[model samples]
Target: MKSALKISGYCLIRKNRVVLDGRVLFETGPMDFSSFAAEAYLHFNTCYPKFHKMDNLSKLGFLASDILIRDKKITESFKGREIAIMLMNSSSSLDTDKTYQQTITDRNNYFPSPAVFVYTLPNVVIGEICIRHKIYGEGNFFITEKFDAILLDHIVNHLFNDGLALCCIAGWTEVNGENYESALFLIEESSGTGSGIANFGPAETESIYQGI
Candidate 1:
């Protein structure tokens, strides 16, 4: 069996605050979801124009992954298809679903935007991340009552053990109205350089997330 995986990096976003590797990168007062995400993008100096066009769900995933892999040193070492992404959330795009519902609620002014309609599925966030990073690896999005660290750990390990991916981005991202939270971790083989958390499993993941 392969050695236990390690957490190379992680980012957490919640309550108008952003934390990376246990350090606060940005914080703000009450703001809408769009403004909150936009502030984070700007704080990181991210220049991706597509960010503005994405729904709240995609934007949350994109920002969390972008921050976690900003340096690119870790991800660049592997092929595009060698990196996977797994994400879960409780809301499952309900935030966008509500917005989309508003457009069609009035029959006389019914106008459902194709742009908004496309993001109804939660997995679209994964596609956005893949598009930005050019990752062609396996990816999936799940909806659960709450974060399930054990399932995430098992699936991530399965991908690595099966040679489906050399590394993975796994975590939870949920956005509902003005409330949003995300915790993303980059999992890969242990390099034994002491550059990351040496032990990565359900317990460790849950601990890190709770602490965040």
Candidate 2:
């Protein structure tokens, strides 16, 4: 089993804007998809300045990790630390898939853009996180009707017990056309709070998806 993990910090992005920085966590809001994407791009660009403009999921993932590291103070100290991602999305990258389909529909005169294909899967975000942080740990993504606290709590606990990762960046990053909102948390073992993962009963669960 992996050693017990603690949630030292957290960061959140909402409607593509930096609603929550470092220790802040914001509730979801009603926002268009394009606006959210643009906001994500903007906040990421501002936070990562040098590397945020890269037009790739991998770069975005790295930027996200960088934010967490800088905010949570988990830096070179966690160079080889096992980290996992449990990212959830509503559409399963339907937006990118639509673009990809458009490319294929006109194969006679169309060639798939590598950029669109790269982000056709929700887990692409996780891959980006892993690559940027050097996390050689277990990673998974799910398409849920909406966020569910029960499933998240159970899975996160399993990861800790199984030694998959010391901590996890578990949340939803859904972008469809021009509507998007995200509410994520940094879940880890902690004796300081409730019961850590186990204590995430109904109350805590409800807390995660506050604006749902």
Best by lDDT: 1
* TM-score for candidate 1: 0.95
Tell me the tens digit of each residue's lDDT in model 2 across 34-132: 444445555544344534433233333444455665555544444445667777767777877887889888758788788778778778777666655
Give the distance in Å from residue 80's predicted Cα in candidate 2 to where it truly belongs.
3.3
For model 2, state the Cα shift of residue 203 in Å.
Answer: 2.9
lDDT of 1: 0.88
Stretches of candidate 1 exceeding 4 Å from the true structure = 192-194
Per-residue lDDT tens digits for candidate 1, residues 1-212, read 86578998888988888888888989999988788889889999989999999999899889999988775455568788888999999989899999889989999999998889999999999999988888999999889888899999889989988989888999999988887889999898886345686377888899989983
Report lDDT per candidate: 0.88, 0.59
C-alpha RMSD in Å of predicted model 2 compared with the true structure: 4.7
- Report RMSD for candidate 1: 1.4
Error (Å) of candidate 2 at residue 179 is 1.2
On a 0 to 100 scale, what is the lDDT of residue 54 in model 2? 34
lDDT at residue 193 of model 1 (Cα atoms): 47
